[model samples]
Target: MDSILNPSTLKNLVFDLGDVIIPIDLTAPVRNFAMLANLPEDEVWAIWKEHNFINHYETGLLDDAAFRAEVRQLLKNDVWADEVIDTAWNTVLLDLPVERIARIQELKANHRLFLLSNTSPIHIRRVNDVLTQLNLPTLEQLFERVFYSYEVRLAKPSPDIYRHVLTEAGLVAEETAFFDDNAANIQAAAELGIQAVHVQPPMTIIDYVKDL
Candidate 1:
């Protein structure tokens, strides 16, 4: 599709929810959780490794209840599980830049837009809250449809999730271009023949599409 050229020649645009649509700064909550639990940052991080949850969820191997329970147990703490989850979850919903929101709207006019995220109902609710605060539109109205790991029982970095998006969106691999902050997820999309971009700050998906 010659993504390097102007307009990127994409028929559909699939975006990752976390850092792409919404800005997520993961460090604050991690440090706070560590201090509250009196645990080392690395140990805490290891305990809550996203791959453990994302991999299973993406493959439809784990449901929300089971996933949440596992996350709670991973803390191995005597504290309340809901509180722990809340703290960890809220930390990720750091901020959403208005500039990014406008950019997505701009692209929607020319191409089919879809959100493919490895997230849960709880997180989705929080995201909506943030969106409301920022005066941004909801997922359902913004894109064709929003794909969530908990809602769809599938996540990124797995072929199943990518397959689901492509099949449901009726987009050919070559016609679709994916943008995600996660490298593994982007690589997975690449393997499926979908053009993928790894999104990092100062190098946004919009930057890749500006001239187009």
Candidate 2:
């Protein structure tokens, strides 16, 4: 528990999905793409990063068809199947630890919990499938509201998204706390008078709020 987030004053908790609740392997996609494209891993990674297609897709600027087309074009492999593209794109997602969900369930007793994530439809569907496979509740059942970048057309580190969450949840900035693995997103929330924690590896959400 950070001193800035005095438990006495916080009434709402906003969480980021990737690397916060769900563990992700950022390099997994690169490896997957390399295998799919039959290209060197470094070359595939360079192409992926240079295209910046992910940002557009996550932000809702690109739809599924367009995203797939862009991926094929960027990788210079026009003959790849959609399944191959999807598999490679989704390799970045790993698993959602059950302990993390249990911790969130515990926190529900005290504060209004919400999920704010920068994600695409493909990734979210995969995550939901995992939850179902594990017999855990869907995200909507676990959190009061789940906000996704593709659905909302807004991404974190953007002030508008934070403002939208506060307004939609009917929460006051001063009474809310946000936890994210990204420093930029945390700082954006803090700038709006919300208590923000920069969650890092080896420090899970359970550790952050257990004391509070």
- What is the lDDT, from 0 to 100, of the residue 23 in candidate 1? 76
Clashes of 2: 0
**How close to the true structure is residue 165 of candidate 2, measured as C-alpha lDDT?**
96
After superposing all C-alphas onto the true structure, candidate 2 shows an RMSD in angstroms of 1.7
Point out the worst 10-residue segment of candidate 2 by lDDT. 1-10
Best by TM-score: 2
Look at candidate 2 and tell me the lDDT of residue 53.
85
Clash totals for all candidate models = 2, 0
Q: Write the per-residue lDDT of candidate 1 for residues 90-154, one digit (tens) a residue.
A: 78686677787788889888889999987766667787777787788877778898888866776
Runs in model 2 with CA error above 4 Å? 1-3
lDDT at position 94, candidate 1: 66
User: lDDT of candidate 1 vs native?
Assistant: 0.75
Q: lDDT score, residue 99, model 1?
A: 82
Name the top lDDT candidate: 2
